[model samples]
Target chain A: MKMLRNLLCSAALASLTATGAMADGHGWSLKKAAAPYAGTTVDVVFLLRPGYEAIEAMLPAFEEETGININIIKHPYENALGEQVRDFVAGGDLDIALIDLVWIGNFAENDWILPLADVQAKYPDAVDPKLDMDDFFPLVLNAFGGWNDTVYGLPFDNYSGLMFYNRCMLEEAGFDGPPATWQELKDVYGPALTKNGKYAFALQSKRNETQSADSFARVLWPFGGSFLDANFKSNLNSAESQAGLKFRQDLMQYMPDGIVAFDHAETVNGFSQGDIAIITEWSAFYSSVVSPDTSKVADCVEIAPEPMGPAGRKPALGGFSLAVASQADEAEQAAAYLFIQWATSKANAREYLERGGVPARQSVYEGDDLEAFKFVPALVESWQDGVPEFRPRFAEWPEITEIVQEWGTKMMLGDVTTEEGATEIGTRMESVLEEAGYYSGEKPLAQ
Target chain B: MRGQVSRKTIFAFVGPAVIGLAAVGIAPLIYAVWTSLHFYNLTKLKKVKFIGFENYSTVLTDEVFWQAMGRTFFLLVTALPLQIILGMSIALVLHQPGLTLIKTLCRLSLVLPMATTYAVVGLLGQVMFNQKFGVMNQLLGGADINWIGDPENAFAMIVFWDVWQWTPFVALVLLAGLTMVPGEVEEAARLETKSKWTVLRYVQMPFLLPGLVAVLILRTADTLKLFDMVFTLTRGGPGSSTEFISLMIQRVGFRGFDQGLASAQAIILLIITIILAQIYIRVFYKEV
Candidate 1:
C-alpha cells in the first residue's frame, strides 16, 4: 500500500513530463485538441457556487476558441451529487462528471468516469502537451482526481479551510489579529469576542455535509484524531477526537444560538453581516464574503490559515475534479476532456483565479508575485502539509457522513454525551467498512 | 354460442383496465418487492444478489428507522387533531348567516397558505425561523431563541407548519360539508333549542362526517409520505429530531445508495399506512 501510494504521489508530476516539449498556442491549444470536435457538445453539472460561476463565465470564450459547446446543467451544491449519480447510473447524456474529493472512490471504482490513461489512449492527438499533473498541488490532485494509482480528473475548484475573521471585531475585543491556535481562540479571543448576543466563531453544523466535513472532520484532524484507525476500525472514540469534540462543546457558549442548524450559507452570512468574529470556511467562498455587494463587513474580513492544535494545522480539505464521463460517446468524451483541460490548464489558471476560483495550479499561485489574493499565501501554507484523507475517500463515506451528521448534532444539542456520540458513530462506521470487505483480506487500507 | 359471445365481450371490456392497473401499479410494487429481497446498492452493483429478508430485518431493527417512525407518528397524531379542530371551528363560524362580504373575503384568505407550494413553505420556514435574522426572532424583540437548532422546538415548528398550511384546506372541506346541511332542519333545531351548540352537535355534525372522514384519510396518508416541505425546512435535522419516515427512506435510498433497505422500509411503512387507514375508517367513518 505504501509503494502504491508512493507511485500515486510520483504520478502527480506526470504532467510535468511535457513542460519543455510544446507546440504553439500557449504550449497546448484548444485549437489542436478540440478543433475536430468543433460542433460537439459536452454536458456537465455546474454547481451554483462561485467556483462554478467563474468557470461558467469562461464558457463563452471556450466556445469561441475551440467551438466545443459546453452545455452546463446548473444544480445547487446539495443536489449536485444526486444529479451526478443519477446521470452516471442511467448512462444519461452527461459528458463530464464532477467528482467531489470523497466521491473519487465511488466513481472510479464503479468505472463511471474514464481514467486519464484511457482518455490519452483513445485521443492522443487531442490530449494536451502541457496538461501536467505536477502543475497542480499534489494534495488537491490526489484527493480530487487520483484513486488506486490512476488519474480520472483534473482539479478544477480545490479548497483548503481557512479562518475568515473580522479584523475590526478582533481589534474591538483588544486583539490585533486572529488567534494563532485553537487554544488561543478558546482561552483568549473567545471570551472577548463573544458578547451582547454575538459569537467568536461560527461552524456550519447543519445536518448534511456541512456537519460532516465542516463541523465534524474539521475538528477531528487538528486534535490528532481521525474517523478511522490504522486498521479501518472506528477511531472516532479516541481520546484526541473526544478532546476536540469536548473543546467544541465547551466553546458553544461563545457561539450564536442555534448554531447546530447553521449551514455554510448561514455561517458565512453571519460573518459577512458582522454578527460573528470568525468563520472557518472553504477558500472557494472567498469571493462571496469579500465582495462589497454581498458582505456588510467586507473591509473588515481577514484571511488566515486555520488555527493550530496539538496535531498541528490540518485544515479541512474539500473540492471537486472535472472528468470525462465514461458513458459519453467517444467523440463526446474527447470533447469533454478538451473542455476540462482548457478550463484547468496552467495557461488559464490566472484567469480562473481572477474569476473567484481557488485554482489548484502551483504556477498560478506563483504568478501572483505581488500576493494580491489574500488567501493565496494561506492556501499555500495549509496545502503544504494538509490532510489528504481529511474525510475518508471511500464509497461508504456518504453513509458514514450521514451517521456523523446525526450523532454529531445530537452531541452538540446535549442530547448525547461526546462519548456516546463517538461510540455510536464508530460502531456504525465499522459496520459500513466491514460490509465493504475492509475487515477481510479483500480490501487494502487505501490510506 | 351465446355463452362464448358473452365471455369474449367480458374479456374485451375488463382486459384493458386490468392491464393498465398491472402496468402502472402492480408491476412497480412487485419490482420493489424483488429489489427489497436483494443486496442492491447502486454503488456496489457487482455485489448485488438475493439476500431475502435480510434488508427487512435490518430496517426493522435499525434505530434510525424506529426514531423516524416515532417522529412521523408524533407529527400525525399532533398535527391532525389540531388541523381538524381548528378547521371545524372556522367552518362553523363561517356557516352562520349575515356578513356575506366579510365571510367571502375570509374564505379567500384561508386558501392562501394552501395555494403556496410546499417547497416554498419549507424555504419560508427556514428564513422566518432563522436564529439571528429570522422574522420570528425579530418579532419577539430580537430574542436569541434557538428555534430550529433545539430538537423539541424544531419538531414543534414542523408541526406548526403542517397545521398552519393544511388547516385551511380542512376548513374548506368542512365548509363544503356544512353547506350541505338542510336549511329547514337547521331552522327547526334552532327553533326547538335556543342553543347553537345543540344545533351544531345534532343537525350539522351528521353532515360533516363524510368530509371529516375524507380529511382524516387524506391527511393521514399525506403525513405518512410528507417529504418536500420538511426536506426543504429542516431536512430531518438537529439529530433526526424532525425526521419523518419518508425522509428516513430517502436517506437510506439516496444518501446510502442502498435500494434494498430503502425498499424494505417503504414496504413496512406501506403496511403501517394501510392499517392506519383501516383503523380510521372503522372508528371515525360512519354510514351517515
Candidate 2:
C-alpha cells in the first residue's frame, strides 16, 4: 500500500515538476540565462559534509549547463563561519556566502550578503521570477535565510533532526519498535536496551555548536520551552525549560559513558559501531548511516521523526543558505546568484535528492525514492513545523551560544544544577542581548 | 680602527634585525594596545569606537576570564613539576658515565613525542583516552574512565599528554647542560662526597640551575599560551573546566569577534606571564 501510494505521489509530483520545469524556461533557466556570465568563476566555501558532497556530485551538470567554474573551497563545519567571516571582512574572492542559519543575522546585519531583492535588482538576468520562493519550505526558508521580512539567502543544504535507530539492536533488546516519545525512550527502552556494556542512545553533546544546537536547544521546544519569551527576555529559567533540561540529565544514564564530549561524528560512529542503539541526529547524515563503508549495521538502520515530548514533537533544525556575497563584483555576483538559483531550483531538486542533497522544496519530497531514503518522511514531518529561531538567529547569538555551550556542558557534567545552569545562561544571555541593544531598542528583535 | 665604533657600520649590521623586530613585534603590540582601549567588535566594525579602558574593566571583572586563569594555573602547576622531575631523573641517568649508547638511544626516543605536532598529540590523546573504544581503556582492562568528558579527568589527561610530549625536550635540555659540566669536576665531587645526593645538590645543581631556569621560562610561556592541544583534546570542556586563558581569549577575539575584550584580556595575560617569569627567576636565584 505504501509503495503504491508513493508511486502515485511520484506520478503526480512528476507532472507538477514538469510544469514547474517548463515554466523555468521563461524566466531564468540556467542554460540560457547563465550564458552572459559563462566564463565567470564563482568562489564559495563548502563544508565537508554529506549535503555538500551531494551538491558537489550534482555540480558537474550545473557547470555544464552554465559554463561557470565553481571554485570550491572546503572547510570543516566548526571553522567555516570564521573562514567566511574573515573572507568577507578582507573583501576576498568568495562570490557566494555560505551561511549557517545562526549566522544569517550576523551576515545580514553586517551587510555581508546581498539581500534577495537587492541581488535580483542588481543582476536582473540572474533573477528567476519562476523560481517560486514560496515553493521553499516556509519554516526552513525563513529560518536559514530570512531576516526582518527580507530574504537574504535561499535555503540550500538543510537538516531536520530525526531519530536514527538500529532496528536489530532494539529487537535484540526485546523491544519490537523504536520509542514513540522521549518519556518512553527513558522509562521503557532505556532500561531494557542499555545493558551488556552497550548504550541505549547517544546525544552529541560536545561543547561548541553541537552542544548548543544538537543537545541543548534541541530539547527546549518539544518540552514547551524556548530560549527567549515573546518579550525577548531569557526564557531558560522557566519551569518548562528546567524540566526539559532535567529530563535530559536523567536520560544521560542510558547514553555512552563519555557522551558529554561526543559530537555528531562521535554519536554517528557510536551508532555505526553498534555501541549505541539510537541517536537523534540530523537528516543530512542519512548517507553516512546507510553507507556500507561507514556503518557496520547499515542494513538494520531505520529512521523516524524524533519522538514526542510533553508538548509535542519539535526536532533540531540546522542548515546553511547560499547568498551572493556583497564583496563580489557585479559579474561574479550575477554568476553566484545564478548558481544558487539553479542548484536550489525545483527543476533540479529530484537529481539533488537522488544524489544526496537534502532539498528544501516542498514539491520535491513527493517524488520517487522517498522510501529508499528512510529519513525523508521523518524529515518532511519534522520540518513541517520547526523552531525558526531554534538557537536564536540574532547577531548576538554567537556570543550567547558560547554561554549556552559553557553552561549546557556544565549541566551535563553535573558541574552545575539544571536550575543553576539555566539561571546562569539566562543571566548571561540577557547580558549579551542587552549589550547588542535588544533591551534598549538600539537593535530590534531578530529571528 | 679596531677600538673605534662607526655608527653607520653598526646601523648597517643591526638595521635588518631592528627593522624586522619593529615590523613584526612593535607594530602589532601598538595595534593591540590601541585595540584594547576601544569597543572593537569585528562584527560591529562600523560601531567600533574609543571606549577608554572599558574593555579592560570588563575583563578584570569577568568571571569566565578568572575561571580560565584558575584552570590555566592548575594545569601549569600540575604539568610543569612532573615534566621537570621526570626530565631531571632521565637526564641524571643519561648523564652517568659509560652510558654513551644508552644516552644516544634515549635522545632518539625523546624525539618521537616532541616531533609529533601539538594538534596530532591532542588527537592521539582522544584515540587513546576514549572510555569505550580507546587503547588506554583496553590496556587497563576496560577501565571506564571518561577521560575527555569528566572535568578532572579531562584536565589530568591534558597534563598527562603535556608531560608525555614535553618531558623529552626538558630532559634533552638538562642533558645538554649536564654535558657542559667538566668531567673532572664531576669525578672530584663524586670522590669527595660519598653521597651522590650531596654531589648532585652542591656540584650538579649549579650547572642545572641555568638549564632549569631556561625550562621554567619556556614552559611558563608555552603552558600559558597552550591552545591547539586543548582545542583538539577537550576544547576546554566538560563545561569549560579545562579552558585556559589562551583558549578563552581566542574564543572571545576570533569566535565571538570581540577583539577589544580579547585584546584587553591578552594584555592582562602578558602582565601575568611577566610576573610569573620574574617570580621564577627570583626564586631560582634565591635557591642558587
TM-score (all chains, Cα) for each model: 0.96, 0.94
Write the residue-wise lDDT of candidate 2 on B135-253 in tens digits.
99888888888888888889889999999999998999999888888889989988898998898898888888888998999999999999999998988887888899999999999
- Candidate 2 on A1-447: residue-level lDDT in tens? 332243334333433443554555465466787899888999999999988888898889889989999999999988898888888988899999999999988898899998776776665656665677667877787788777666778889999999999999998878888999999999999998888888998999999999999999888888989999988998988888988999999999999876778998889999998889999999889889898999998999999899899879988999989998999998898899889988888888888887778999999887675778788888989887677778888888778888899999989988899989999998988988888888898887753
Question: A64 in model 1: Cα distance from truth in Å?
Answer: 1.0
For residue B127, give model 1's deviation from the true position in Å.
1.7
Q: What lDDT, from 0 to 1, does candidate 2 have? A: 0.87
| Number of backbone-clashing residue pairs for each candidate, in the order shown | 2, 0
Weakest ten-residue segment in model 2 chain A by summed lDDT: A2-11
In model 1, state the lDDT of residue A253: 78
Best model per DockQ = 1
Any runs in candidate 1 off by more than 4 Å, and if so which? Answer: A1-28, A368-370, B1-22
lDDT value for model 1: 0.87
lDDT of 2 at A151: 76
